[model samples]
Target: MVAFMRRRTAAALLSITGLLVLALSNPAGEWWTALQQPYQSEDLIKCAYDKCIPEGDDWFMAHLNQTIHPFLTPQSNLSAKDFLWWKKLQRDPNDLAAFKRVVDKVFQLFPEGKGFMDSGSQRCRSCSVVGNSGNLLASHNGALIDFSDCVFRMNGAPTKGYEEHVGKKTTFHIMYPESAVDLTDNRTHLMLVPFKTRDLQWLISAFTTGSIKFTYLPVKAKINANKDLVRILNPQFIKYVYEVWLRNSGGYPSTGFLGLMLAIHICDEVNVFGFGADQNGNWRHYWEELKDKTLRTGLHSGTEEYRLIQKLAAKGKINFFPGH
Candidate 1:
């Protein structure tokens, strides 16, 4: 019995040691990095495609202006933080050009949204990109976020009672084949971000008979359903975002960021909320539960990508509403 007690005690000690190591490493002090460029210059570089001189070698040089000198700040100065984070990812010219192309094609996907550039009459600004978090259950923020001209939501967003949480007007619903399995409602328009070439084939198969009438925006031109509204981009764009922006740049920028950055490259002003964290830093809660909720068993509950999201939110660059 004494030996058994000793063994258990050693195991407990090891467990505590491991946990302490993780907490320190988790929000590690090392990541508080400074950028090489000034904030204003980096902002100019971020919007360089439009901000820079007309067609010159100096265009790429604008990328050099991108550095982490001034890092994350509140919402008012997030664009520069995004640019700084993006700069950390050492993108080769080929990859960078490819990403820019994706940004360009997303423009065609929603030409109405892009008209903001020419007429300057009106544009969909201040979008509240809502994530499906359980904290939103009774919080009632849907209406506020949905009132925006364009709303993008994903993953089992049960818009019935929560309509007031984010708003009932879900303009776009990003989803996958295994959609209805979740508590998904019928109002959301499905936008599939395919993980496999097989997924593309499945879309084509269903699209032919008109099982799905919604527009398709694939990285490659061939997969687009309505070539007019299809908005086919080079696969390089997805590759670049995956490699540079998502992988190399500190960590994964939530789908919200990918979509927001896409939105900003086209739209005017963007406001983001309901992303990144639970009330605590747990980072795994759902919109159906409270901020402290542990969450039901699911794939999204234990993803490294999700943890990276929490880290960015903790940095305070983005607005992550805990209780909706």
Candidate 2:
């Protein structure tokens, strides 16, 4: 009876181990990351033609509703303390109340109710995070970049002259006061990456009466973007991206890093273009001939960010096109 029991136990263990091995070897196991969309690619450069991140579905929507809804909701009021806590705000001793007022006003500017790309409304939204790397100078990826459901451009990477290399389609232009540009495309959404309370004030004044002109840096007095389409980045969301997504890589998150994080939340599929250094190992913009030796990424760690981006590509979370 003891021998028979031992045989039965050994047989059961073997069967269970085989089943586990089969599941692990399958396409939907540890071999493939859950965050990445399904794709078949033999090369390092992946093409996400129909791939969509599963998290962008109802599961993510429910999670956002339960956690991030308060921060995104327009009716919610954000105080100066909230801003200070989230960001490393160095405000004047006398400007506390004024800062709070600006925060409140900025929150009011946010679109009321749920986001337009909520669970019920969103489909397989493909997004392209177009950076200003010089690698895109002669790539002629305009049509390919434009084919995406939405294309995000950062700073003032213009498409007027470089239409063949970088598409003219700008679904969203993410920028701060210093990098602000006049949006000629009426359809483009002007998304603000507010680094400080003064940045928010600049945005408000730019759209309304053009009152606040000068900030820590010189800013555009007025922008050509539609007032109704302006979207402000939530301070809390910025903190979340910094601490949670980026694991606090640098003192503060770079605008490019923040933009990619934003894309992950809103886009079902993400394809990145015009990011990282060029073939010559110089950090330069596609529109300019000037190249910086240091590859200045400001307060943020640019190299680390680039590696993280590459890691994401390997995991299939994003289809990273190395441009040149």
Candidate 3:
């Protein structure tokens, strides 16, 4: 009996020592974290694409900060501290109280009740981010783009005539006040990328009062969109994309880049189409004629954005279909 007790005591000591060693080795307590919170670890956390860290691509996981919420909820109120960085993009001068009033009015109408896409589920959501680059002209990606679980389009990218190239199905249409267009399909969610407090005000006014018509330039007073289906992009998310993803490369990320990042956050599989310049190296829309061959991105770093997109494709984070 004495011998057996001694052996048990020795085994307990060995186990304690092993645990101590593990604690020292993992100072961040990552192993313990993984065990306690399964699938929350960077290695185990699956994106909407149904994968965590892609093989041979540590850069993506390293840069991807999951703490950022990409959309504004009714509870997501921007404090004065957060507004300091957020206001820099569009030089918004509105105070915190003024911003809150606009936001309150917005939620009153939109009422982000629940069932947002941020919540993870067993079902895998695939997405196709369609840009308006001229490269999509000849490429017959319409069928493929529409087949995705979600299709994201930006600005005034019309799909009536170019359905053969650019898909007819638009799950989400992203735009600011200046670029806002009336959505004929009530099924499509109108995602407003609010650059300033005015943008939020515009969203409310466009749907109701139609009083706030002008920003830096004249914007549409009223927009025909489904009030229930309207969504607003979080301003903090824009700052995150600027600092973390783009590394403050451009003045700010373009609408297309923001839309792509949104897909990455919410979808299991992301497929990109209609980005970058065309074969002739002209930066023109697929539907429009090349009036100016020298046309290029002014505010945003188009070149740097394209480079990052290429790197993402090369790293296998996204399957890029560079339309011909």
lDDT of 2 by residue, 55-103 (tens): 3444334323224432234444555665576546434333546666776
Candidate 3 lDDT tens digits, 183-296: 998778999999899999889899888998899999999999888888889888888888888999978999999999888887766789988999988887888898877779
Candidate 2 regions exceeding 4 Å error are 1-51, 54-66, 69-73, 76-82, 87-100, 107-110, 120-122
Minimum summed lDDT over a 10-residue window in model 1 is located at 68-77
**After superposition, which runs of candidate 3 have C-alpha atoms over 4 Å from their true positions?**
1-56, 77-79, 113-121
Error of 3 at 262 (Å): 0.4
Best by lDDT: 3
Clashing pairs in 2: none
Clashes of each: 16, 0, 6
Error of 1 at 162 (Å): 0.7
Candidate with better TM-score, 1 vs 2? 2
**Per-residue lDDT of candidate 1, residues 252-289 (tens digit):** 33444445444334333333555545455445535433
